[model samples]
Target chain A: MIKFLESIGTNILSWIKITQGFLSLVGQTFYWIFFGFRKKRPLKQEPILDQMVFMGARSIIIVFFVTFFTGIVLAMQSAQQLSKLGGTIYVASLVSISICRELGPVLTALVIAGRIGAAITAEIGSMQVNEQIEALDTMAINPVRFLVVPKVVALFFMLPCLTVIGDLSGMLGGYIIGVNNLGINSHLYIQTAFEYLTLKDIYTGLSKSLVFALIIAFVGCYQGLNTRGGAVGVGRATTISVVTSFILIIVADCFVTGIYYFTNL
Target chain B: MREHKVAISVQNLVKFFDGRKVLDGISLEVYQGETFVIMGGSGCGKSTLLRHMTGAMKPESGKIFFGDKDLTTLNSDETEAVKRRFGMCFQSAALLDYLNVEENVSLPLREHTTLDPKIIRILVKMKLNLVGLSGFENLMPSMLSGGMKKRVGLARAISMDPEAVFYDEPTAGLDPIVCAVVDKLILDLNKKLLLTSVVVTHNMESVFRIADRVAMLHKGRVLQIGTPEEIKNSQDPIVQQFINGRLEGPINFAENIDDVNFAGEG
Candidate 1:
C-alpha cells in the first residue's frame, strides 16, 4: 500500500517533469526527427472545425446581430438619460465608447466561451471518461500535444479576429439607432465616436479577448483531461468549464483593465 | 506455426493502483511469430501488464525485455525508439473522429516513414484492402459500423510493418461472425507478416481460435500458462468457471464490488 502511494507520487512528479520538457522544446523538433517520431500516437485534432463552426461561424449571426440590439438599447437609454441633463448629443460618445471599448470584446468572448468552451469540455470529458485518453496513450501519443495544442492554436487566433468583427457590428447598430432614428446628427455621432474610442480603449478590450481565449481553452481542456466517471462526469465538466470561464473572464477583465490603468502599462 | 525465438520478456514486474498492489511480482516470456494470449477478468491487471510492456505505464520494479533490449531500464527516448518496432490496437478502437479511414490507417506510416503522401496513399490503399476496408478511405469513424471500425483499427495497427503488435480485447463486444472475421485477420496477419503478437482477451472462443499459448491471470497473479486444450482440461476451478461462463465462483460479485465498502453508496 505504501509502495503504491509512493509510485503515484513518483508518477505525478515525473508527469511534471515531462510537461516541463515538452514546454521547453521549440516548435516541431523531436529527438526522433530522423528516425520518425513513431510514438506520435494519433494527433488528437479534438473537434476544432466542429467547435469553430458552432462557436465561431454559426454563432456569428447571433453574436453580432444580438449584440447589435444590445448596442441600440445602450444608445437609446444613454440618449434619454443624458437628455434630462441637457447633454443628449454626447450620448453618442458614451454609447460608442462603452460598446467599442468594453462591452464588445468581453461580451462576445463570454457568449462564445459559454457556447464553444462548454462543447470542448463536454466532448473531451466524454472522451476521457470513456477511456479514450488511455486508449490514445496506449498507442503512445502525447494527449496534450495531440488534444490540447490545436485548440490553443485555434481559439487563441480566432477570438481576436471575432472580437474585431463583433465591435464593428455593435458600433454600426448604435449608429443606426443614435443617428438614423434618434436624430443625433449622423456626422456628429461619427465624429464623437471616433474621438471617444482612443487606441488605449480599443487595445484594452481586445487584450481582454485574447486573455479570455486562453482561459476558455485552458479551463475547458483541463477539466476535460481530468474528467472521471462517465456521461455525468462529462456533463459536470461542461458546466464547470462554462461557469469557470465566465467567472474568470469577468474577474480577469477587471484585473487586466485595472492593471492597464494602475501601472499605465 | 513455426518454432519462434524470443520476442518479449518480463521479469519480476510489480505495479500498484490507488495504494493497492494490482500487479504483484510477475514474470513471462513471449516468443516471436506467435499469438501470445493473456486472459484475465476486469481488474486482474491484464491491461496494466500490457501498458508496462508497451511503455504506456512503467513498472514499479523489475525489467521488461524486447528481444533482450532491457526496455525497463531505458530512458524515455530509448523506450520510444524501441516502441516504434511495435503497434497497438486498443479496446475502444480509439479512432480519431476528425480523420477518415485512410488518414487513420496512414497515421503510423506518416509518423514513421518519410514516404510522400502519394506513396503513403498507395500503401494506405493496400492496407485498407488487406483489412477488408478498401472503399472506406474517406469515411469517418462516426460513419463506420462496429465491425468496420475494428477493421480500420487493424489497418492502422499494421501500417508501420511493426515487428510486433499488441491487441487489447480485439474481438470484444462483436457479434459471432465479426469475431470470426477478427480471428481470421489475426491468424492471417501472423502468417503473412510473421509478426509476434500479444493479445489480452477474455473471450474463450477468441482464445481457442487465435492463441498459440495462453496465460490465465487470477487475482493479480498468473495462475496457469498452457495451450487451449491444456487449459480446457485443467482442474483449476477458476479457469473452469471462466471458460464455462459459470456465475458462481471465487469471483464474488456484489460482496467485493468496490462500492460496497464505501460510505458514499448509501
Candidate 2:
C-alpha cells in the first residue's frame, strides 16, 4: 500500500513538473515575440518564409482531400434521414454550417498535427540530441528566436489559410452530393448553403485554427527541445508531440465551441 | 608557461545532477595561448567541467571567470556575447544536417556578420582548405565519413577565428591514423592562430601529443594539474593506473562488477 502511494505521488509530481515546463516554454515564446516587435526589428523573416512554404503550401493537397471526403460522408449520412422526411433541401444548411464552423478547423488541425508536428519534433529533437542546439547557443544564437519563433509564426498565419481552403473544398463536396445525388436543385442548394453560413461561423472556425496552430507548434517544440537519450528519444518525442497536439486540439475545440455557444446564447 | 596570464579561471565550482555531485568544488586556471587538456575516465565529469567553463551549463555554486569578467554573474545576452568569443567542436561533430559543408562552415559568419556573399564564400573555402576539405564544399554531412565530419566540424569551429576553441573528444571514434592527423592539425592550428584551447578527452595518446598542460579529473575532483612530464612522473596511484591502463589499482573495476551482480540478484 505504501509503495503504491509513493508511485502515485511520484507520477503526480512528474506531471506537475512537465506542466510547469510547458507553461514556461509558452511564456518564453510569447516573450520573444513581443520583445522582437518592441525592438523595432521583429524576428528574422527568412526562416519564417521557409517554414510557411513547408507547413502551408506543402500541406494543402492532403487537407483538401481529407476534408472533401469528410463533407461527402457527412452529407450522405444526413441526406438519408432528411430525405425520409422529404426535407432533402436542408442538407445544404447542415453540411455548410457543420463544415464551415467545426469540421473544417478540427480536421485541418489534425492533419497538420500528424504531418507538420511530427516533422518539427523529429527535426528539432535530432538537433537536440546531436548537440546542434547547444552549438547554436554557443554561437550566440537564441534557439527559440532562431528556431521556434519562425515555426510558430508560420503556423499561426498558415493554419487559417489552410482551414479556409478546407472549408471551400468541403462545401464544394457537399454541393456535388446535394445537387447530383440527393436530387436537390443546384440553385436552391447553393442559396441555402450561403444563407445559413454567416461570416461569424466562418470567423469562429478560422480563429479556432489560430489557437490550434499555437498548440501544435508549442507542443512539438517543447517535446523536441526536452528530448533525451538519442535516436530512440527523438522517435518518442515525435510520437508524444503528435499525441499531445491531438489531445490539446480536441480539448481546445470543445472550450472554444462551448464559449462561442454560450456567449451567443 | 607558468608565468603566463590566465585566459580562464574557474574557482570553487560545484555542480549536481539528480542529487549527486558531478563537479565538486574544483578550481583551475587555463593560461593564455596554450593547449590545456582535461583528461579523465568516462563519467569522471571532464566534459561537465568543460561545459561549465564554456557557459553551456551552470554550476550549482561557483564562479567561472574568463579573463576578468565573471561568467557566473552574466545575464543571458551577456553570456551569449561572451560565447561569441569561443567555438566548440562537439564529439559527434554536430554539423547541421540540412546544410551543405560550405553553408555549415559559414553559419557563424552568416549569423554574426554582414559580409558579402563572395567574401563569405572565400572565407568558407579558406577554412575548408585548412581542414583539407576544400573540394567537399557541396557535400552533405551524411555523405562524409567519421573523420571527414570531424574535420568539417573543426573547419566550422575555426571559420570565425574565435579567440578560444573547446574540443569535446575530437578523436573519440577515429582510427589511429586519423587520430594522429587530427592531433597534428590541432597542434598546427594552435601554433598558427595562437588560440587558447581546452580539450577534454580520455585518449591517453592525445593527451601526450597535444597538451601543453594536463589536468586529470577523478570522481568530480581535480586529481592533479601539471605539465605532461610532471603528470607522467607523478606518484599518484589513480593517475598512474589511468595513464597506464592498469586493471589493479585504488580505482576498482570490481566494484562495478559487484554492482551488476547485486542488481541481478535483486
Candidate 3:
C-alpha cells in the first residue's frame, strides 16, 4: 500500500514537472518571437522562411487530399439520410458547415501533427543525441531561438493557411458529389454551401487551428529537446510527439467547440 | 607556457548521476596557450569534468572559473556571454546535417555578428582551409568522411577565433594516420593562434603527442598532473595501468564495464 502510494506521488510530481517544462517552453517561444530582438540573439528570418517552406508548402498536398476525401465521405453518408427526408439539397449545407466548422481544421491539424510534428521531433531529438544542440549552446546560440522559434512561428502562421486550403478542397469535394452523384444543381449547391457557412463558423475553425498549431509545435519540440538515449530515443520521441499532439489537438478542439457552442460564437 | 596565466580553473567540483558521484571532489587548471590533456580510462569522469569546465553541465556542489568569472554563479545570459569566448569540438563532430560545409563553419559568425556576408564567407573559407577543407564548401556533412567531418567540426569550432577550445575526444574513432593529422592540426592551431586548448581523451599516443601538460583522472579524481613526459613515467599503479592499456593493475575493470553499457558505447 505504501509503495503504491509512493509511486502515485512520484507520478504526480513528475507530471507537474513535465507541465512546468511545457509551459516554460511555450513562454520562451513567445518571448523569443516577440522580445528576442532586443537581446544579443535576435531572432533570424532565414530559418523561419526555410521552415515555412518545409512545414507549410510541403504539407499542402497531403492536407488537401485528407480533407477532400473526408468531404466526399461526409457528402455520401449525409445524402443517404437527407434523401429520405426529401431534403437532399441540404447536403451542401451539411458538408460545407461540417468541413469549415470541424473536419477541415481538425483533420488538417492531425495530418500536420503526423507529418511536420513527427519531423520536428525526430530532427531535434537526433540533434540532442548527437550533441549538435550542445555545440550550438557552446557557440552561444540559443537553441530555442535558433530552433523552436522558427518552427513555432512558421507552423503558427502556416497551419491556419493549410486549414484554409483544407477547407476549400473539402467544399470542392462536396460540390463534386452533390452536383454529379446526387444530381443536385451546381449553382444551387454552391449557393446553399455559402448561405449557411457564417463568418463565425469559418473564424471558429481558424481559431481552433491556431490553438492546434501551438499544441503541435510545442509538443513536438518539447519531446525532441528532452530526448535521450540516442537513435532509439529519437524514434521514441517522434512517436510520442505525434501521439501526444493528436490527443491534444482533439482535446483542444473539443474545448474550443464547447466554448463556441455555449457562448453562441 | 605563456606565463602560466590560467584560462580555466575548477575547484572541488562534485556532481552526482542518479545518486552516484559521477564527478567527485575534483579540481584542475588549464593554462593559457597550452594543450592540456585530461586522460582517463572509460567512466573516470574525464568527459563529465570537461562538460563542467565547458559550462555544459553544472556541478551539484562546486565552482568553475573561466579566467576570473565564476561559471556556476552566472545566469543563463551571462553564461552565454562567457561561452561566446570559447569553442567546443564534440566527439561525433556534431555538424548540423541540414547545412552545407560553408554554412556550418559560418554558423557562429552569422549568429553572433552582423558581419558582411562576403566577409563571413572569407572567414569560413579561411577556417576550413586551416583544417585543410577549403573548396569543399558546398558538400553536406553526409558527403564527408569521418576524418573530414571532424576537420569541418574543427573549422566550425575555431571560426570565431575563440580564446579557448575544449575538445571532447578529438580523435576517438580515427585511423592512426588521421589521428596524427588531427594531433598536428591541434599543435599547429595552438602554436599559430596561441589558443588555449583543453583536451579530454583516452588515446595515449594523441595525449602524449599533443599535451603540453597532462592530468590523469581515475575514478573521478585526479591521479596525477604533470608534463606528458612525467605522466609517461608516473609511478602510480593506476596511472601506469591506464597509460599502458593493461587489463590487470590497480584499476578495476568491473566498475567501468557498467559505464560502457550505461553510455551505450561499445
Candidate 4:
C-alpha cells in the first residue's frame, strides 16, 4: 500500500512538472513572437510546412468525424434530461451554447491531443531512438526550430481552425438530432443557437483552443526531443505525452471556462 | 615533428551521473587536419566527452576551448555559431527519416546558406559522390541499409564544408567490411579535404587504419594518448590490458562484458 501510494504521489508530481513544461514552452513562444524573434532560432520553412500538413491539415478527417458524432450524442442525451423541466424545447440553447462555447473546443482538442500528441511523441521518439535529434545537434541545427516550433506553430493555428469546423459541425449535428429525433422545430433551433452564441463566447472558445493546441504540441515534442534510453524510453515518453496532454487539456478547459465566466460576467 | 596548430583543447573535464563518474579528468589537444580517434570500451564516456567538446551538453565541471574561445561559458547562439564550423556523423546515421537522401544531404547547406537550389543540388551531389553514393540521393533513410545510411550521414556531415567533423561510434553496428569502408572514407575525408576529424569508436581496426593519434579513455580520464604504434607498444598496464585484450590487468570491463569477448589483439 505504501509503495502504491508513493508511486501515485510520484506520478502526480511528474504530471505537474509536465504541465509546467508545456506552459514554459507557451511562455517562450509568446516571448519569441513578441520580443525575441531574432533570439528565437531560425526555422527551416520547408520541413515546418511538412509538419503542419501532418499535425494540422492531414488530421481534418478524424477531427470532423469525432466532432460531429459527439455533438449528436450530447443533443440526444441532454434533450432527454431537460424534458424533466418541460425544457425539451431548450435543446437548441443547450446544444448551440455548449457546442459553440465549450464542448466543441474541448472535444476537438481532446481528439487532437490523442492524435497529434501520440504522433509527435512517436515520431520524435523514433528519431530519438534512431539518433536523429542528436544528429541535428551535431549538424548545428536547432531541434526546437527544426522539430518543435513547426509543430507548435502548426498546432497554434490549426487547432483553432479545427475547433471552428468542429463547433459548426457539432451544432449542425445537434440541429439534425433536435429536428429529426427529438422533434424540435428546425427554424427555432437555429435561431436560438445563434441567439445564445455571442462573438465574445466564440472568440473565447477559439482562443482557449489555441492554448490547448500549444500545450499538446509542446508537451508531445518536448518529451520526444528529450527522450533517452532508446526504444523503451521512446515508448514511455509517447504514453506520458498523450496522458499528460489529455489531463492538462481537461484541466485547462475548466480553468479557461472559469476565467471566461468570471471575466465576461 | 611539425608544429600542428591546436584545433580543440579539452582540459580537466570531469562529469558524473547519479554519483558515478563517467568522464574523470580528460585532457587532450587535437591538431588541425588530423584524424584524432578517442578509442574506448562501451560506456567509457567517449560520446559524453565528444558531446561536451561539441557544447551540446554542459560539463558539471570542466573547460573546453575551441582555439582561445571558451565554449563552456557561451550561450546557445554562440554555441551554435561555433558548431557551424564543425560537422558531425551521429552513431545511428541520424538522417531525417522524413526526408529522402538528397534533402538530408542538403540540410546543412540549406540551413546555413542562401545559395541557389541548383548550386545546392550540385553540391549535395558532390558530397554524396565523395562518399561514393551517387544515385542513392532520392531514397529515404529507411530504404537504405545500415552501411548506406552511415554513408549518407557522412555525406551530410561534410555538406557545410566544415573545418572539423566529429564521428560518434561510426562503425559500431555495421559489418567488418562496411566498417573498413567507413574507416577509409574518414581517412580520405581528412586527406582529400584537409579537414580536422575527431572519431569516437571502440574499433581498434578502424583506429589502426585511420588515426594520426589514438586516445584511450578508461574510467573517464584518458588512460593513454599516442599513435597506434605507441598505444600498442606502451608499458602502461591499463593500456596494455585494453590493447592486449587481457582482463586480468588494471582495466576493468563494465559488468557483464565477459573477458572472452575482449580477448584478442590489443
User: Which lDDT tens digits does candidate 3 get at residues A1-265?
Assistant: 9999999999999999999999999899889988987785566788899999999999999999999999999999999999999999999999999999999999999999999999999999999999999999889888898999999999999999999999999999999999999999989999999999899999999999999999999999999999998899999999999999999999999999999999986
Candidate numbers, best TM-score first, in rank order? 3, 2, 4, 1
Tens digit of lDDT per residue, candidate 2, span A125-182? 9999999998888877778887898999999999999999999999889999998898
Ten-residue stretch with the least lDDT total in model 1 chain A: A26-35
Instruction: Give the alpha carbon lDDT tens digit for every residue of B30-126 in model 3.
Output: 8888999998887778888988988889999988999899999999989988998998999999999999999999999988889999999999989
Instruction: Tell me how far the alpha carbon of residue A189 in candidate 1 is from the true structure, in angstroms, after superposition.
Output: 0.5
lDDT of each residue in A95-207, candidate 4, tens digit only: 87888788889888999988999999989988877778878887777666667777887788889998999998998888899989888788988887788778887888898
Sliding window of 10 residues with minimal summed lDDT for model 3 chain B: B257-266
Best by TM-score: 3
Docking class of 4: medium
**Best lDDT among the predictions, by candidate number:** 3
Candidate 3: what's its TM-score on chain B?
0.97
Q: What are the DockQ scores of the candidates, in order?
A: 0.36, 0.86, 0.92, 0.76
lDDT values for all models: 0.79, 0.91, 0.92, 0.84
What local lDDT does model 2 show for residue B49? 90
Superposed Cα RMSD, model 3: 1.4
Pairs that collide, model 4: B24-B220, B243-B266
Off by over 4 Å in 3: B1-3, B261-266
